[model samples]
Target chain A: MRRKASLILLALAVFFTALSPLLRWYAFPRLAKIPANQYQDMVLEAKNATLLDYGTMQAKTVPKVTIVQTLKGDVDAAKKIDKTAGRDVVVWDGLSYVQGPDGKMVSSIPERYIFDAHTQDPVHATGEMVDGDPVKRDGIEFKWPFLTQKRDYEYFDAQTRTTNPIHYKGTENFRGVKVYYFEQTIPWTKVPFPKTMPVKGITPESVAKTGTTRWYTTVRKFWVEPVTGAPVYGEELHKEELRGGTLLGDRDKVTAFAGDVKMREDYIKHTVALVKSNRTLVLLMVSYLPWGFLTLGLLLLALSLYLEARSRRPGDPASTEVQEPEPVNA
Target chain B: MRALIAATTGLVLAFALVLTITAMGSPMGKTSPKPLLTTVPAHP
Candidate 1:
């Protein structure tokens, strides 16, 4: 009976010991992914920014410029893609809307981003586009992959429609959470006009017919929580100009928009809280639970071996006299 | 016989608990709250 008990315990020990690595490596990769129906929004503000007054065809200083960015997961779209892609995929329908201090619209651009839910690699589905133009993305975009490493990543730029290396600077404590800092600088590039212009009848085609083109550049920065790979805080030193166009009259160029855009205070606080909670969940699977199971397995195995060894000892008094005593009683 | 029954019951419960944890930890069937902005409004 003692030997049997020991064998059962030994089997349990083996089971748990095998489970540790399986949970961490196998289950984590397959199960820990971005949900297909996630929806999030953020507001960023730029104070004292320069914005072009299209009516006056000149640049003017604005008290504040706000950019509202929203990303909503398309569940049906993802499900359809999964049927053919043969793997988990996520589709995000995103919009970036810019407004002036008066709450008047400036420009808005729409995007459809498709990627692998686990790896965050671009899936290049049929409907992937930016600003109404079909684009085949090469690398990461708004979100990074889980367990992000300390190295440069090829980050795609919506304005330039190109990918550039976003270099990791170092780790820093951000709002009580350790985060990795990354920076990317995009050089001035001629970008197409927004498909939805602020003024009626002032379309991209109209602007191009006037011999004017839009140029943009930015220095983007993010403080990302490594475990969840989500940015706790972000900022951009962004600038745009309308160059050498009849729309600008005799002026060489006019600043369409220029400011240091930063996430709103309330949004920052909320983001930090969310990332902290998600970090805990990821750590539970990757570190805490796995290690706990392994430790428990080792302890149980030790106890089982001890019990088996003691039961098998020939010098044990109970084992030596047990048979004679039972026969006499019978 | 009672001891064997108890041990078997415990083992089954433990296995079930592990499976439950694995399913809960995954992203499957998890959906976020409703979004504030659904459709982009036309700009003037």
Candidate 2:
């Protein structure tokens, strides 16, 4: 009975020791994965430009650029500068604008704006439009409380905390693969839309009267790897699809779409390699380490049993047992 | 009692072996860098 109990306890100890590190480092990291639907505003900054060669179809070009991304959100307050005599600038500011796709009001933000000019320099502006409407400011036009509807803009932090609850949208197809999707707020650098028409250049004060700004929102698709349980990729189409009155229009005027599928794949490859090359698991399964225990336990148990068996020798059986002397001798 | 002592000793040996193997493997673990892509917002 004691031998059996020792063997069982030894087996348990072996199992637990081998399993502890795997559970602590590998299994746990994989389990605590970030969900696809909850990611918002991840900025992908390229360290160096990448070259893409399309054989005979296209020339090799290194597109040096930085990308800013955000999930769709509500346009709380907006200003439209439809008509600026110098440069057609559209400014969207204020705090009251916090409706996101998940139906929560968020105030955190980084200053983001897009104007029709690459440089906010003084330029000749023949025509101007704000929120798709031409503005005619007579004099001193200050629309703060009226523009933002009396709300302040929220600033985002490095930690990227979620201001609202996560609402899981259904799965959808991206590029070619099907994936689960969610909404997040990402940042993007503005691509300047410069309108170049020859005219008398004016100062900010000259045409400042007729400019306005407005806020808008659009939905994006997030793709995740089902097997790995990682946020693999996603894309977003601009809210306003049409540009310059055409179905297929210029890239800047249409919308901004972004994705991160390729990067996620690379990370997965590295993880698989790291796990497979794990030396501990391999040695434990194949080496003489485990067999040593089996041998020792069996040796001790066998010796004990042998000793018990030898105690039952025929000649010694009666001698081994103690007997009381006869009453007659007393 | 001898048998129990033997098993306990073997189990302790097994723990030592596993720990050594794991430590050797730690240096081989690798974390690949994330792929990054940026598209310049098309200018009109």
Q: For every candidate, give the share of true A-B contacts it also has.
A: 0.13, 0.05
Clashing pairs for model 1 are none
Q: With candidate 1 superimposed using the best TM-score fit, by how many Å does residue A178's alpha carbon deviate from the native?
A: 0.5
lDDT of 1 by residue, A1-330 (tens): 667677778767766776777779877887888999888888888999999888887789999998888888988889899999988999998888898888888988889999999999999889999999999899999988999999999999999989899999999999899999999999999999999998898999999999999999999999989899999999999999999978887888989999999998888888998898899999998999899989987988898888778887898853443444445563
Quality of candidate 2 docking, DockQ: 0.07
**Predicted candidate 2 versus true structure: per-residue lDDT over B1-44, tens digit per residue:** 75456556655665575556544432211222221112212220
CAPRI level of candidate 2: incorrect
Standalone chain B TM-score for every prediction: 0.53, 0.51
Q: Which stretches of candidate 1 lie over 4 Å from their true place?
A: A318-330, B1-44
* Model 2 error, position A216 (Å): 3.5
TM-score of model 1 vs. true structure = 0.89
Residues A1-330, model 2: lDDT tens digits = 433554555554444444455434443333222111221233332223322121221212233223434432112211123243332233322111212222232122222222222122212222222222233322111111111111122222111211222224666654444445555443332221112111235222332332311112333334443333234454433221112322222322332222221223333344334323432343344333435434554555565555545555668653275557868863
Model 1 per-residue lDDT at A120? 93
